[model samples]
Target chain A: MIEILLLVHLILAILVLSIRSLFTAVILMAIFSLFSAVLFFVLHAPDVALTEAAVGAGVSTFLYIWIVKRTQKEVK
Target chain B: MTTTLAFDLIGYLFVASSVVSLYRVLWGPTIPDRLLGLNVASAQILAILVLYAAKEKLHVYLDVALVYDIFGFVGILALTKFLEKRHRKGE
Candidate 1:
């Protein structure tokens, strides 16, 4: 049901936010964003869902990965 | 009864994650970590808006979510560019 899906999404979001590795964080965040978009759709907000899908899954993740690649060597 | 319980459960889950995201924003080690936490929080805000829209049977919240989406993107891009500039200047 919706509750289960939401729980999974929350867990993923927590994993994304708490993980140490930048690369893994980006991937987990991408997944988290995708699920958030789906949650929006389930909540009957197609416009918000579309924006979330494009921005979260598409642009934000790409930006995060690009920055990670650019700054990977600097990490301690 | 089941449906109400389901909605309540999901709502609580969303709230819990939002709280955790706030914690990340508070204690994030680096600038990017802070930015990422902020971005995720905004995304969660959008999700909450969408949920409210459904619960209240109103479309106006969707508009707010759309605007928030644009603002979050621009803010993240600006922060990233600013960070990059600072890093370069430090080099």
Candidate 2:
């Protein structure tokens, strides 16, 4: 089960990097964090999961969106 | 035995959903579509956490999921507010 999860995580990461849209990529980055958190949990590292969930999925996504909002080009 | 099978079944389903959502994240023509994809991705992640905790019978994993819930909420809220501010600022 855990190995399958790891495989999924690797696929997601590669997809995120190869994608064109920055926003979509950023969101994948968020999901990537959750994958790591689950991986940590499966490995019996609750403390690492706690931080990954709190910071990776939480703070970083907001910051990425903020930067995107600030720097996004106007459509028209 | 049956319960574990059920849990794995649900987990696989969620993994598929996340994979499907990746398309939107990869080539969403508009910003809103991509945002929605991201939102769905996060929810599916929470579901995965719940399923795992239930199957493993771990109290601490549940706690981690709760913290994930709170942080994910805050992240989305902040992003929405930022976008709204940008909209109102006439950018």
**Against the true two-chain complex, what DockQ does each candidate achieve?**
0.05, 0.60
Per-residue alpha-carbon lDDT of candidate 2 for residues B1-91, written as tens digits (9 for 90 to 100): 9998998899888877876876786577876777787788778877888888888898888888899999988877776676678679895
- Rate residue B29 of model 2 by lDDT: 81
Best by lDDT: 2
lDDT of 1 by residue, B9-37 (tens): 76667766865775565466665676777
Error of 2 at A70 (Å): 6.0
> Each model's number of backbone clashes?
0, 0
Query: How many pairs of residues in model 1 come into backbone collision?
Result: 0
Q: Write the per-residue lDDT of candidate 1 for residues A1-76, one digit (tens) a residue.
A: 3675587677777776677767556655755675576577667677787787677765787677678766863335
C-alpha TM-scores of all predictions: 0.51, 0.78
RMSD per prediction, one decimal? 10.8, 3.4
CA deviation > 4 Å runs, candidate 1:
A1-76, B1-5
Q: What CAPRI class is candidate 1?
A: incorrect
